[model samples]
Target: MQHAIHPAYGPVVFRDKAADFAFLTRSTLGSDRTVEWEDGRTYPVVDVEISSASHPFHTGTARVLDAAGRVERFEWRYGREAA
Candidate 1:
């Protein structure tokens, strides 16, 4: 909590463009972008690629990993001799 030593901690908007999602939270991160929120207040907007709203795992859209297929591919490439 030393003065002038730490980055400013304040409200920042994280925007997920793909899902059209945004949320306000306090953090040390920031961006040059700005956005007016529902409350009619402008906040620093940070664009993100994914968030809980768009993430496959969080939204139940996740694809099952093909573990067996990967194992077979690895075996094929390296052979069983590669223990």
Candidate 2:
């Protein structure tokens, strides 16, 4: 452990605008915005575009890529020549 060499780790809110989700957790991330939490305390707010709440994998909205279609498109653009 060292003194005056570590980042400030405290309660901060991660806000996902797309999903309208927010959660408070300890982090070393810096922010200038503040918000009143459910516990009646103010904490720094960090705006994030994507989080687990809105992420495709976590929310089961992930799109399956069509490999066959891509292969066909590629072949059409460039003649198939086995190297």
Number of the predicted model whose lDDT against the real structure is largest? 2
Each prediction's whole-model lDDT (CA): 0.93, 0.96
Colliding residue pairs in candidate 2: none
TM-score of each: 0.80, 0.87
Which TM-score value belongs to model 2?
Answer: 0.87
Looking at model 1, which ten-residue stretch has the lowest summed lDDT? 74-83
In TM-score terms, which candidate is top? 2
Evaluated against the true structure, the overall lDDT of model 1 is 0.93
lDDT tens readout by residue for model 2, 1-83: 98999999999999999999999999999798899999999999999999999999999989999999999999999979999
Candidate 1 Cα misplacement greater than 4 A, ranges: 72-79
lDDT of 2: 0.96
Model 2: lDDT of residue 5:
97
